[model samples]
Target chain A: MSLTRLAIKSLLLRPARTLLTIVSVAASVAVLFSLLSFNSGYQEGLQKQMQQMGVHLMVVPIGCPYEAASLVLEGGEIENYLNESVAEEIAGMEGVAIAAPSLMHAIVRPEDGRTDIYLGVDEKHLELKNWWRLNDGEKPGPGLLSEDDAVLLGWDAALIEKREAIGERIWVPEIESEFSVTGILEPTGTQDDGFFYVPLRTAQEQFGLEGKITAVQVRLTDPSMAAEVADALDARFAGVEIIRMEELLGSMTALMDSARALIFAIVAVVIAISGVGVLNTMLMSVFERTREIGVLRATGAGRLHIFSLVWTETLALTVIGGVTGLGLAAVAARGVEAVIKRFVPMAPQEAMTRFDPHAALICVLAILGVGLVAGIYPSLRAAQIRTIEALRSE
Target chain B: MAIRNLWRSYERGSETVHALAEFDLTVQPGEMVGIVGRSGSGKTTLLNQIGCLDRPTTGQVIIAGTDVTALPERELVAFRRDHIGFIFQLFYLLPTLSVAENVGMPMLFARAHDRERVRAICERVGLADQMTALPGSLDGGDMQRVAIARALVNDPALLLADEPTGRLERQARDEVLDIFDDLRADGLAIVMATHDLEQAARCGRVIELRDGRRLEHAYEDSWPKAHCAT
Candidate 1:
């Protein structure tokens, strides 16, 4: 018979105890992997969300520091406007690739009869945009919104409308506009989802303001020159505030990194508890089988054979536990994602919240290592047992 | 093989209990010798020392020209596996192993020249059809036979049987004696520990012990009335 069969049968001799230990260790691995997955998912989701908002630079109309920063960083309502012509002057400078200007505005209606909408401009001056990628159809053509007919909406905006209204006109009662829905943008789980799109001229004209734009989005052909581009734009635009997308991405990344580290520290303690369980099980088996060990020694089994048998038994249990734990963690991760959505609604919808196979593999190997080392003390004690005394023990 | 002035003890804690005092023993190759003693007597201890299961405190146990007492613990294990076979009162068969497995245990571990020969010997012990049966289901006599099969399978220079018949009834005891007769006829040296006088008398020689010291020696010529004792 194979050594594995021997180990499994040996463990089966005390079926209840062995199974309990396996479960305990497995639970530990599951907890560790689950926490690890959660941390990674959050970090990944946060980074993806930030990147989706458009990277590299944010140029806003400057005034009060918090207002301008809030307007550029978070999605602040129309406080001031940065003109479109000023963008052209910045674009002619070095380190700029594709520049698109947009007017950012929010329409608040009653959530409980409070206005609850954030609208955006999809204009001809920025129609061939760098960041507003079209996942479904072509961007609304020039003058699509000029005739007060067509509009492009985000996916969540369409979902909130309570039906399939593409190719039909939908009304945003808060803004009090009746615009035809041409297409739905893909879900990016950012401010993009919370906003609607109309031609920039239409938005300016509707808001009773003319010859005005919000801020310019500039993508550097070389990402490494983002800081240089931000500084140059700041120098050229007088009162305009330049917020580099790199800085925003860095802050978001830092928040996620700290959160992940916190979760991993907690999981480490849980894993250490599980390691103790493995050690306890091996120790108990050695204690009960002292006579059997002596018989094996008498039967000409070497010290290494004794060591291997014991180590294999523990290692086998750990592997079984690790794999089972992974299965449970994945099942739980689905529920966790649902809960996370209830709180952080902007978690990247495309980013999966599930146990990672790469991380699970590493956890399995680490547990097996723990198993081998755990069995050593017990195996040595078993090996050192004097055969004559062991055989003669009652 | 000869053991002169053999001494041994079992010290668990503060208590030092003498297991065997001074003992003198001799047995030629292919001879069957029975060791008889009471419950507390060192019959088992004497057998254990010669079986290489224990060491003499102050004497020598010479088996096949090697004083096993002087060998290292590692080599001692090798010596025990290769040169000796054991049959215990409890029929200490590996419960997980089949009858064939139990019979083949010593031979398998011995790294012997012929494994099929061991199976052939197992068949001679009357377990020819029950080779696949686990020990838990076997009767007392059959279990003894399995242990005996293991003891003789490796064809060791010395066969040690400790109270092999103690766990059996009179009929099963007689059955075991019948198998021992075949072993003796094949000229395999066998030493058995027994409390039964009839079992001991059937051997070519019998040594009685009490309190770890040898008390009497009864050879076939000395026990002229052994046939009548049964």
Candidate 2:
């Protein structure tokens, strides 16, 4: 029989202990997989969101920049509004390319009591937001801007109302108006998919705030001129805040880094604890097999051979557990994604737990490293056992 | 094989205890040498030293004209694998392995035996019919036979058995003795430690140990001793 075979049989001698050790390692691996999957998915989703925003700078009323950000990014409710005339002033500023004005509103349908996002966009606004796509008819033109009876429905908005929105009329109970859909926007798997879009003049007329806008989206002629233009705008536009998109994204990246560090710390602690479990199991195995070790030594087995036997057993357990843990974590992640999608509507649709090949490779290597380190003391104890003393042990 | 001025000592709290003190002996090939001793008389310690399982505190052990005491640990392991076989009072069979696998185990470490050679050795030890059975399923005699097969599988020059038949019935003990006689007839050197006078009488030379020292003819029993070969 080979030494590897002997080691495997030795572990099989106590099925319960072996299985428990494997399970401990499995739990550690599962935690690592969950953390890494979430980290990768969250980072990727945030990058997509940042890319979809398209605008380089945002102008919001003073003291509620975050609320305005949430209003545009998350379709959150906001009461702040800036004068529509600010768009013309921003358009005329140095290094400004496009100034697309928009208004945000939230109202609960009197019929269903469900809240929905309502957005007002000028004809030029769609040209600046590159990610938007029409699933059906063309966007509302300048003609529709003066009509106040046309609308575009987001994909999820149609799904929520169970309406075929291409030619359907929908009632806006808050504004007490009925509007015909010009088109339905394709699903972007973002906040945009859950909104109702109308012409800026129509929204202004319906809300009776004809001369006000919620935010002005600015695009720089050269992105490198963003800091200077933002500072100029900040100085000239009093009682309003100018936010560079890159700065917002940078802070969000920093927040994610902190979250990643915390998750990795938790993962490391769990793996260390699992390593201790492997050490304990191996030590107990060595103690139980004292006589067998003595017999092998007496039969001319060397110290290295004994050491390798115990180490091999530990590695086998950990590797098997690691693989099993990965499979379990992947299935669990899918379940978690389903639960989140059903319960948390504001969560980014693309930001679900996912494991890529790179994360899997890292987890496998880490578990093997844990196995090697944890197996050291016990294998050495097995190797250094005195043959006579071991034989004398019962 | 010869041992010169051998001593094995260990610390017992504040004092030192010598398990084997200034032991000297030599044996020839084809000879069965018996060591008769009382409990705690250093018989097991002497076997342990000769088997290279423990390092001596002070001494020289020359096996086949090589000074094993001066050999490094790695070399000692190689020397032991190639030169010595061992048997224990408890049969010392790995319970997890089948009879054949237990016999083939030393060869796994030595990296020198094939399946046919293992089968042949098992047949010679008279355990051919029990090769597939686990040691736990075997009777006392069969387990000892498996241990003998394991020792002989590597064809070592010296076979050191510590109370090889101590745990066996009379029939099993006689059967083990017959195997020892066959091994001796095949020109193999055997060193066995035992308390049974009948077992000792069959050996060519019998030495008795008491309080870590050796004495010739220390027992007053009228036991016949076989003549040693020159």
Candidate 3:
């Protein structure tokens, strides 16, 4: 019998096991791609968010690095503060071009109000630092408490307060301080969407803390001078620390790199395991089809012919499994796209979530290689089976 | 003589099987012989050795002047394709292929044979009508006819049949016997292994084997069976 027909029949003989192997390998590979998506997507989002907003330095209070980092990144608590004078002091420093003082604090939801909203900083210097271009409303005025009676809501902040932009009044519960929404910023999949922005004086007054703020961000005259400015600031301000944007990015990227490495290791191990799976399945098939192979051998099929019959069969099975797995993954990505759409309407494009076709092709080629190599030794074994033994194997 | 020094062969293990012990056989350019033996009589093993599907451990198996017993496995395959035809009891037709494909299989592998000869063999087997049908759909007699066509596709010099009538009923067996008679009339050399004495009686000569040796050769029967051999 020709190897093509033989292989197809052999694989089709045990439909469930072959399909199960296909699904298992596909799942492992999909998970690998999922990790790829997460690491690259997250890293891309962070860099893109930073690129859009050109803030180069972030100065926060000493101790509690993770929490403070999260606060500035994901708006973890909005409840810390640094002096407004610090911005002025840093602005006079040699390499510093602009020092923007920002207040970040939280207030309890109003007792009678139906939402659990908190008030975060909405500083002019903070907005200028982030280049917070608005979709609506005017910029905050440039005086202490100048915009204290007003606020700007981000996409998620508006949902939190259950209010709309342009003339919605909300009260802060813990301090009985009230403000109106004056501006709304666009969605960027960054921290801005979760916090409310207001004047530093207004946040201090509302939270009942005076002369205190969270972080003082500095912009350098030259972008390359950021590390030097950060070092100088760290030396100048005792009990305070300076963080360059690049450093924050490097560590975040490192965390993602570790995840990438982990997935790489997992993919290698699973492929090896599947190689054994291919071998076992083909071996059983070879044993069962001994009589058939012998018949062919007796009919003048050469050793190469016998070997190719085995090799082709192995190739066909693995390639079918690989393709089916990828097809399922394509369907799975649609589901993931839908879930992400429900959360971030202006999320990154769906193409961003797709696996690169080359990578996908590589996965398929890897699967084919796994199948054939896995079958190579077994095929040779089948070829070595004597014609008499094969004919008599019964 | 194509070859000489032929001897008996056996495969031994714990069972001590003697497939072809102390047996001397010969085939000239044109001859039709019938071999009759009971199960375990080694008729099929003897055919396998002559067919080059196996090598005799101690005997010399020469086919068309080539010492096939000592030939390498690759050349042995080529030897079988080039010189021998095999007909099995189960009618080993590939189920997925059409009748024509099955007939074309040996020719395709042999490759040295003419393609028109393959078409002519199918026509001779009376399978021209059923050439497009797969083996799965053919009746027993027609299937045997296809098997005969496959055996004749390469126009091989030596035809070996191992109980070709064993799987068929009396009518189908008789139909297959008719084809064998025709081939003998056409002067094709045939060695058929069968368990039925009545079928053996129809051939030009009958050789009865026991204990892996030829017990008797009824050459006188050829006078009466001469009409079948034409």
Leading candidate by lDDT: 2
Ordering by DockQ? 2, 1, 3
The pairs that clash in candidate 1 are A56-A245, A108-A115, A109-A114, A109-A115, A109-A116, A110-A113, A110-A114, A110-A115, A111-A114
TM value for model 1: 0.83
Better of 2 and 3 by lDDT: 2
How would you encode candidate 1's per-residue C-alpha lDDT over B40-155 as one tens digit per residue?
A: 79887787788776778988888888888888877787787777778878887767777877677655445553657756977898888898898889999999999888777766
Model 2: how far is A200 from its true place, Å? 6.2
RMSD, one per candidate, in order: 4.6, 6.0, 6.7
- DockQ for every prediction shown: 0.39, 0.64, 0.34
Q: Model 3, which residues run further than 4 Å from truth?
A: A1-6, A9-56, A59-151, A154-165, A168-180, A186-241, A334-353, B1-3, B8-17, B107-119, B184-187, B216-230
Ranking under TM-score, best-scoring first?
Answer: 1, 2, 3
Q: After superposition, which runs of candidate 2 have C-alpha atoms over 4 Å from their true positions?
A: A59-149, A154-179, A183-196, A199-242, A335-351, B9-18, B218-222, B225-230
Better of 1 and 3 by lDDT: 1
- The 10-residue segment with the lowest total lDDT in model 2 chain A: A338-347
**lDDT by residue for model 3 over B1-230, one digit each (tens)?**
13243445544665556667766677655567788778887787788778887766576766677888788877778878877888888787777677877777776565554657767888887887888898879888889898888887777788888889988889989989888888877867889998876677777776677867777534544633542365
> For residues A1-394, could you state the per-residue lDDT of candidate 1 as single tens digits?
4456556656876878888988888788877776667666776767655544544676777866467545443434556776768767767878776566766555544354423343445553334343454445455355445555566666677677644656687776645777787666766555566456777666676666576777777767777788888887877778788876676667766767666666667777877788788888888888888777766665565566667778888888888888888887777777756664555433556545675877787678778877887777877777677767777776
